[model samples]
Target chain A: MLEPVMFTGGVYKHDLVMELVEDLGGYVLQKNVTQSEVILLLLVPKEDMEALKAIISDLRGELVRAPLAGTEVAVVTPTLAIHHLPHTACDIAEYLRRNGAKSNMIGLARGVGRETAQINEYESMLIDEHDAVVFIFGNFVECIRKKEFLYRNINIPVVVTGGPEIPKEELPYAFEYVPSVGRITHRAKKATELGTLDKIIESVGRALDRTRTDISKDPLTTSPPRVMDAVREQVPEVEYSFSPLPIALNLNGVRIKLPYDKHKDAVRAVKFDEGVTLGEVATIRPSKMKDYILVRILPMSETGFVF
Target chain B: MDPMEVFKVEIAGEEFGAKKYREIIMDILQDLGLIRSIGRLYVYVDVKKPVFAVYGLLRTGIPPLLVRDVADVAQAQGGFQIKVNDEEHMSDLLKVLWAKYGRERVEQPSRDVVVVATDTSPSDLPVADLEAEFRQDLTDALLRIAPEGFRNRRNEMTDKSFFFIAAEDTLKSELISEVKEKIRSMENA
Candidate 1:
């Protein structure tokens, strides 16, 4: 089993940590440098976690298990107006990022007012690209219960947050409901407010676990990380894309930041050591997000073999 | 302790909603530095009808911000020199100076100094209308304090007080009367 962890320390000798992870057959998912400090998100072998911890302690660094690492989560709000932005939505998105999830904040165009609240086809499809979604609602119970239409068509698991405490049975469409995080005009500083953020992280963790369990039953022919490696090596042009994380990983697939029409053939030609090409194992389609290429690997049932 | 003399938030069914909305209003008001200017505030929210109304009595009228209030004024060789202490309102001060004395008569010699060629002291000249600025900020805060779905809004401001109502549905004359009645009862209690 691979353990997802985050390493935080000074930039003096952070490369040693990276070298150790590479030697232990682990993958450094992301590396971020902020002035004097560095943060690394890694997938290390479960047994070798102790060895990694010892080195981190020697470097006086901090290590925490990041269950949501290597996953993309969407922090969705009704609208981009001041009423719903820079406070509650930003706090939730920042909290999700601190827990090691690549969070994307999405503001719906016409997602205001009870009667006029809507999720366009493009908005729904964009949110569907993420592994999971967290829909932030307001203080009213009636409105929270009525806003189910926003996530009814969404395929991924959605964790809904609001102000009041309502029974889960009332919201059948939502995977989980987190309360006490509704409309606020201040930054989250109180213990109770921070606790609610932790609960959100926990709920998202459970939602991703459910997806992992379902994928295990009909496992993909190859892991997403392995395909990510292959694609990164084959499609060097992907590095030139302006996106920070050029290749975004999902549970079942990866989103190549390259344009679909031009680079679809190059992406399809990526080959693995088992002598199988990507075009044979995965379905290549245009992403709902900005015309990028999306690849979903076929399950072993359809491929008849696993590499 | 409450900041305002009489602050009351009444929500029909949800007690928690009332309490949270109270904090939200206070946070927004304090953020805009308008809490002290408000003497008494009454908020009424009807989730069933989904209407939010706020009635507030102003403490006192705020005097217009003058150029001298934001800077140091002294007589120079050919003009009155202003050493701006608050750069935030420098643009407003400059605009006022340019309008009073023609553009050629106003000169900014340094980053924070403005020289105006006029024998009459520009100290008494109003740089910005504080009452108008306060009204604008209060309107912004009210829009943010209300729920996102409350699109249709009505704002009535007089010299001494202000009334604001927001609703998801069309704000009709009948709804305004009903909201006023609700707020009156809240104020009495």
Candidate 2:
């Protein structure tokens, strides 16, 4: 099994850590360099953890389990209006990022008001790109209950947060409902307020885990990290794309930052060591986000092979 | 302790919502410095009916800020040299000076100094209408304190009190009465 872990150490000799993981048949998911320090999110093989730990200690690095690593989550609010942003939404997004998930904040254009709250087709499709989504609602129960249509069509797990403690059955469309985190004018600093944030993180973790279990039923023909590695090696143009993370990894797929039209053929033509092209194992399509290319690895049931 | 002499919030069926909105109201009011201006406050929210109402008694008698209140005014050789003590109201003071003594006669040699060539004392001139500004800020705080979903709004303000209500659908007279009655009962309780 590949254990998800995060490594925090100096920038110097970080390549040695990456080389060790590559040699151990593991994947380096993300590398974030902030000045002199470096943070790497990796999926290391469980049995060989001792080797990586020894190397990390020698380099004076820190390694901790990152359960939400290798997955992207979307933090959604009603609108970008002053009422919903800068306090609650930002706190939730930052908290999720601290737990190793790459969180993206999405503000719905017309997602305000009780009876008038709505989610358009484009907004829904954009949120669907992430592994899971958390919809931040207001204090009122009627408004939260009335806003169920926002996530009814979303395929990924939807974690709903609001102020009132409504029963789980009240929100059937939501995978999990976390209460006591409604609108606020100030930052979350109190112990109770911080506890609410932790609850949200836990709910999201459970939601992601549920999706993980379902995906395991019919495993993808090839892992998304393997595809990410192949694309990175074959498509050199992706490096100059100006995106911090040129290829964003998802639970089932990876979003290549390169434009779909120009890089479609090059990405499809990417070859693996098993003598199969990437196009044979995954579906490459235009992403709803920023004209990027999305690749979803086909399940073994459909592709009839796993390698 | 409540900053206002009397502050109350009532929400139907959602005790947590009521408590949370109380904190949110205080936070926004305190952030905008509107808490002291409000003497008594009553907030009533009916989530099922989907209406938000705020009726508050105001602590009026906020005097308009005069040039003398914010600065030291003295007669100079050419005209009046106003030395601003509070830079926060410097822009307001400058606009008043420019309007009183035309742009040519008013000169800002430095950040804190404003020279105006005029026979009349500019100290008596009003620099800012703080009462009006307070009302504007209170209105903004009301809009923020109400849920974002409550789009349709009505605000009735006087020197002594302000009544504000917001709802999802087109507000009706009957709904206004219902909100008023709910707030009245909360005050009584």
Candidate 3:
């Protein structure tokens, strides 16, 4: 088992952690540097956790389990207007990021109102790309229950949040219904409010776990992190992409931030240790999020082998 | 410990919605500084019909802000010297003075001090109409308090009270009367 963890330490000697992870046959999924501090998201071998812990302790760094790391979760709202933004949507997205998930905030253009709420084909397609999606709804129970169509066609797990608690049976389409987080004008400072945010993070974690279980049955030919590493080594130009994180990991795939048309051939031509090209093991296509390239690794059933 | 004399929110069949909207309304009104101006506030939301309404009685008679209210008007040689106490309305005061006494006559030597070259006292000059400003802010707060989807709106503002209604669908006379009757009953209760 590979344990997903986040390492927070000073910029000095952060390369040691990355080197250790690589030496242990683990993948350093992401490296973020903010001024003098550096944050690394790594998938380390569960048995070799103590070795990493010793080095982190020696460096006076902090290590915590980031369950949602390596997965992209969408923080969706009805709209980006004053009704849903800067409060519920922003708070949930920030909370997800704190838990180590690369959360994306998506505001539906026409998703509003009790009777007039809608999610267009393009909006649902965008949300479907994420591993899990949390839909932020308002206080009204009827509106919450009526907005089920928004996620009805979504292939990924849906975690619906609202003010009132409705029975799980009422929202059969949603994977989970997290209640008590609705519309508000202020930041989440109160204990109960922060508790709700924690609950959302927990729900998203569970949703991601469910997707992981589904993927485990028909496992991908290669793990997303391995593919990410291979692609980073082969397609060095991906580092030049203006996206803060050049490659974003999803449950079944990784979203390369470079333009699809420009980088598709270079990405497809990437080589692996088993003498197989990336084009043979994964489907490279245009991502719904921006013009980035989405690489969904083919399952073992299709590839007839696993690295 | 409510700020207003009577503050009530009623949402049919949605107790949580009622409580949450109460906070939302208070937060928005307080943000816009319209809380103290409202004496009594009643909010009704029927999500089934999906209509939202706010009826509030405002504190009467907020006189216009005069130059003297925001500044100290002193008798100075060749002009009446004004020392601004509140810089928030300094620009408004400057505009009012410049419009009345041409820009050449209004000499702002310092940031907070203004000298108006006029024979009459500049103390009584209106710096801002508080009543109009309050109404404008109150209207803005009401629009924010209502749900974003509630595009169709009706606002009836009088000298002492204001009644605002918003809905996703068209605002018809029958719905208006029905909401008025409901608010009136809440008032009587």
Candidate 4:
């Protein structure tokens, strides 16, 4: 088993930690360097965690378990307008990031008003790219109840957040409902407000857990992090991309930030140690987000074997 | 503590929304510094009808901001030299000086000193109308305070008070009268 963990420390000698994880058959998911400090998201072997810990401690770094490390979550709001942004949506996205989830904030084009609110096909497809989605709603129960049609078409688990307290059954379309985090004009500062943010994180954690459980039933031919590592090593041009994380990981796939038309052939030819080309084991398609390439690894049920 | 003398929010069938809207209105009004100018505020929200209305009584009689209040005016050799103490309104003062004594006549030798070649003292000139500005800001705050879904709006302003209403659907005369009646009852209650 591989354990997902995060390393935060000085940029100096961070390469040693990455080398040690590679030597232990683990994969480095992401490396983000901000000035002198660096943050590395890694999937290390469970039994060899101690060896990596020794290297991290020697390098004077902090290591913590990041259960949601490999997955991307979408923090969706009704609209990008000032009414729903910069406060409720931003705080929820920031809170999810602190818990080690790569969160993307998505504001719908015409997602305002209870009667006039809507989610188009393209928006639904983009949200489906993530492992889980958190829909931020407002205070009124009637509005909350009326807004169920927004997420009814979404395949991923939807975690709804609002102001008033409504029963779980009241939101049948939602995987979970977290209350007390409605629209606000100010940043979340008070302890009670922070507690609501914590609730959102916990709810997202549960939703991701449910997805992980379902994925475990029929494992993928190869893990997303392994594919990320293989692609990074073989497709060197991906490094030149301006994206911070050139490759974004999902529960079942990874999104390569490189342009699809130019680099599709190079990414498909990525070979694994098991002598399997990525094109044979995964489906490479144009991503709904930008012009990047998306790779969804086939499950063992289809491939008839796991690496 | 409440900033206004009487601040009441009523949202039928949703007590939690009423409470939250109260905070939202207070926050926006206080942010724009319009809370002190409003003596009484009554907010009536009918989620079933889906209309938001706000009625406020202004304190009234706020004197206009004059050039003398923001600067020191004295007669100089050519015309007049004004030394601005409140640099916040220096731009408005300069605009007023330019309008009064053409841009060519008003010379700024330093950051805070403006010389206007005019015999008439610019001290009595009005730099900004505080009441008018207050009304504009209050209207903005009301637009923000109302729900994002409420697109159609009606703003009624007088010398001493203002009545603002917002609705999702097309607002009619009957709807305005109904909302006004609701706000009046809220004020009485």
iRMSD (1 decimal) for each model:
1.4, 1.4, 0.8, 1.0
RMSD of 1: 2.0
lDDT by residue for model 3 over A22-92, one digit each (tens)?
Answer: 99989888888999999999999999999999999999999999989899999889889988989889999
The local distance difference test score of each candidate is 0.92, 0.91, 0.92, 0.91
TM-score (all chains, Cα) for each model = 0.95, 0.95, 0.97, 0.97
- Estimate the TM-score for candidate 4: 0.97
Which candidate gets the maximum DockQ versus the true structure? 3
lDDT of 4 at A85: 79
Q: Candidate 2 residues B9-115, lDDT tens each? A: 87878888888888888889889988888999998888777788999999999999999999999999789999999899988888888887789999989989998
- What candidate 2 gets wrong by more than 4 Å, as runs, is none
Worst 10 residues of 1 chain A by lDDT: A108-117
Q: Enumerate residue pairs that collide in model 3.
A: none
Q: List the residue pairs that clash in candidate 2.
A: A113-B149
Give the alpha carbon lDDT tens digit for every residue of A1-307 in model 1: 8888999999999999999998998888878889999999899999999999999999999999888988999999998889888889999999888888989999999888777789999999999989999999988788889889999999999999999999999999999999999888888999999999999999999999999999999999998878887998899998799887888888898999999999999999999999999999999999988889999999999999887
List per-candidate RMSD values in Å.
2.0, 1.8, 1.3, 1.3
CAPRI class assigned to model 4: medium
| Reference-based lDDT, residue A108, model 4 | 91
Weakest 10 consecutive residues of candidate 2 chain A by summed lDDT: A110-119
